[model samples]
Target: MRVTADLDLCQGHQMCQVEAPAVFGTDPDTDQVVVLDEHPDPALRPQVDAAVKYCPAMALAVTD
Candidate 1:
């Protein structure tokens, strides 16, 4: 699976990072959501999905 983020829509909430630290992160300066692993292992799909779902800004997406 692949993870993508819309930085413009990100609100620095960091929920994505909290949900899936292995696949998502936040920029220290901007505090925006960052995709740590654009292409994460299938084993991490559940985490990735949770991250996307919990993102308040709705900036995260998954493509499989």
Candidate 2:
């Protein structure tokens, strides 16, 4: 699976980072959502999906 985040759509809520720190984080300067990995392991897909679901701004997307 692949994950992507629209920086423009992000409100810096940090839910994704909170849910999966290994795959997501916030820029220290801009505080925008940063995708640490686009193609994560299958084992991590669920967490990624959860992050996407929890994004209030709908900035996250997953493609499998």
TM-score of candidate 2 to 2 decimals: 0.95
- Which candidate's TM-score is highest? 2
Off by over 4 Å in 2: none
What TM-score would each prediction reach against the true structure? 0.94, 0.95
lDDT tens readout by residue for model 2, 1-64: 8899998899999999988888998999998999999898889887898999999999999998
- Clashing residue pairs in candidate 2 are none
What is the C-alpha lDDT profile of model 1 across 1-64, one tens digit per residue? Answer: 7789999899999988878899888789998877878999999888889998998988888987
Reference-based lDDT, residue 15, model 1: 85
Candidate 1: regions farther than 4 A off: none
**How does candidate 2 score on lDDT?**
0.92
